[model samples]
Target: MVDSVVLVGCGNMGFAMLKGWLDAGMLQPGQVHVVEPTDALRERAATLGVNAVAGAAQLAAGLQPRVILVAVKPQVMGDVLPAYRRFAEHATFVSVAAGITVNFFEKHLGDKTAIIRTIPNTPAAIGKGMIVTFRNPHVGDSDAAFVDRLLKTSGAVASVDDESLIDAVTAVSGSGPAYVFHFIEGLTEAGVAAGLTRDIAGLLAMQTVYGAGALAAASADTPTTLREQVTSPNGTTAAALKVLMGGDRLKNLLTEAVHAAHQRAIELGKV
Candidate 1:
């Protein structure tokens, strides 16, 4: 269990993580501190009984948190990160800001600061997200495990030894949700174009996507096996599979798309 934690932002993702932590009993409300400049957001955080303040300046004097989560946007991270530098001597820092590198955190906090850079999709809001972490050498084994459990409050967590792989993680999971959403949208539109009512098409599209994901997650069989199970020679599923996998067109397109996102993530992390 975490003794004390400081959350630096409480926007959509941040707030969701905080709520998950509280709900999971990771820390007591009294043991958590939230720094949110916006009045409404701070109040929302306070509603959870945590010590919510407008800024780091308002934190109780001499209070040092054991774990500090930096959830602010990358664009504003420069302005917000310095406030927590005082805790560099003690706290283990975790960042969920996309495109921000571990080196970037070292530059802002301290070269030896124990930092973990993680990418969590928006699904984390619902406790089903995928989070991939890469920790700096300064982080101890115990603290690294602590981070893994802390993130699990929001969803599943994995780790990568090589920091550079984080860029690929960003492309595959960080930006992958939008791709799924777009597929659902396209499926719904296609249904409508095929003469299904808009309402029915939307429901079918949503439920099919949700069910498929849930089944894939719960089943031990590989997705390839699942696909084969649903497909038969000259069947409708086979026809669709042919359109999607024929000459590996869809596979090539998806590979290119992930590559594009990976490259962009790398570019965004530039110092």
Candidate 2:
């Protein structure tokens, strides 16, 4: 029963989700309202035919959106939440600002407000991202389901009842795209070192990662089985894997990286 939505802050991530919803036809432009302080950003949203305003005070009088999604930076959220507190009684408050928890929203928006905290990555701009959410107890099943439908327009959506798992989500999918991008950069450098032209090397590295990820997603076989299928004994792929996986080198490094990110997420939540 989500009839309309109010999206506060239309920066990169916010704009991406906004476009996703409109492009998917899940919600009409008239049904969406955007509040962005930046002129260029607000104009960008206006071009999409949605109502775009500079602040909450400019929002249509008597507005009661089903969900008010706050996408501003975590640092500024304290100043932003108070203006929208009036909507807490009816509208579900959804925050995409990292490290801001459900309890923080309740403290600002009232304890009775339904709040959803989510971590979404940059890939969502292209409609290919992973978004994970954790909802406060006040959120009803229908409201949760409606939010899921809205989030799905951007990418795959998953939820967890245990709010603590959100930090793990931040470490994993929320920050994972950068890891994959870095790996592509390294692979491209290696290709250039092996005597390939820089352009050719970059293209190969990018396509290989893209193709492999697509295959992994489409195939019924497990990734381990797929890797084994491509790697023959004493072959080139095997040799490469030996250097990468010897003594679990790559695995250990990734585990350490994820752990560091997880710890940082926990620390941020405390702030």
Candidate 3:
């Protein structure tokens, strides 16, 4: 078991992860330390009984954390990571910052340090997130398992051997929540246009999407097969799908969007 974990930032995503870990009994508050510069965030973390510090220098002398979770923004990582290098000699470093590569941590922490880069979606706050992870070659199986267990506190976890696939992962799962949200918005608007009240439209749109996603996750059949099961001869679903599936409009659009997101993730890594 990890004796101590140091969290670098306590933003929305970071705080959600911390809460999930604590609530799921994956970590104890007494064993966790958080470094959040903002007073509001620090106070928030402190309320959870975590030792919230304004900076790394505030950590007790000679303290060595078992894991240092880097949750800061990618643009600020270079400035923030060096201070944690002292812990790298003994601890595994896990970064949840989007678009930040393991190479970035390796550069700051040195070649021998174990590093894991993970991308977790927004749904982590609700304990239904999908996280994809890639570990540096320096990380052993044991260390990888430890990191995976920690992540599973928030939601499902998957590991990929190829680091390059991380960008693709970011494109699909990382940005997927936004796509789903936009779909909900579109559906709600269409329902309203179809003469339903705004509140009713929203309820129908939200529940339908939730039900569809739940069915997709629980069903044994493939999504294509499930979709076929829903469509009947010249039915309403078929009529709607005609515009969506015709010329593969939705598929092509989503492909373009994912590609754009993948490119942006690569660009963020370079920065």
Candidate 4:
């Protein structure tokens, strides 16, 4: 169990991670402290039996937490960080804000502070997220492991040695859920165009994506092999595949999309 943790935001992402930790028996409610400015948000965290405060100034005096996880938006991170600098030397700072780099944290905190930068998708709220982390040189192996353990309560965790790859990770898994959601919308529209009611089309589209994803995760075979298994010569599935796979149309479009997202991620980092 973690000795003590300070979650410096009680928004959707922060609240989700905090709930996961308590729900999974990874940490006791009393062991966590949440710092959220909003009254309602702070009260929400307080309902979980943890200490909730409006700001860092209200934190217990002489308190030292093992981890201080920041889930605030990147735009206000500069303003929010200075208040927590007093704890930087002793605590491991884990950030889940996109486009916020380890160097940024180091600049706000200190060069020697242990920091782990992570990008997690919105699905993390439901314990089905893909969390990718990159640690600075100041972080030790045990610190990395502890952060990983805490994050795993929300979903699967993976690490990258090169921080640059995080931009690609953001383009892929971080933004991938939205792409899948758009695809579902398109599928539903297609179903409607094919004479199905809006309600029925939505159910079919949503369930098909869900079921296919579940199957793909559970199957040992590659997606290509699984796709081949479902496709018959000149059959209905093949007809659809022909439209999708013809001249790599779908692949090209997705590549372009991911490239756009990747470049945007790089640009955001520069900001």
lDDT of 3 by residue, 1-271 (tens): 4478899999998899999889989999999999999999999999999999999999988787878899998889999998887888888899898877777788887878989889899998788999999988877887788778889988899989999999999999999999999999999999999999999999999999999999999999999999999999799999999999999999999999999999998887676
Per-residue lDDT of 186 in model 2: 97
Cα lDDT for residue 63, candidate 2: 88
lDDT of each: 0.93, 0.94, 0.90, 0.94
Quality of model 4 by C-alpha lDDT: 0.94
Q: Is candidate 3 or candidate 4 better by TM-score?
A: 4
Q: Flag regions of model 1 displaced more than 4 Å.
A: none
* TM-score of candidate 3 against the unseen true structure: 0.94
Query: In angstroms, how far off is 236's CA in candidate 2?
Result: 0.8
- What does candidate 1's lDDT look like per residue over 71-110, in tens digits? 9989999899898889998899999998888888999999
Best by lDDT: 4
Spell out the clash pairs found in candidate 2: none
**lDDT per residue as tens, model 2, 7-97:** 9999998999999899999899999999999999999999999999999999988889999999999999999999999899999889998
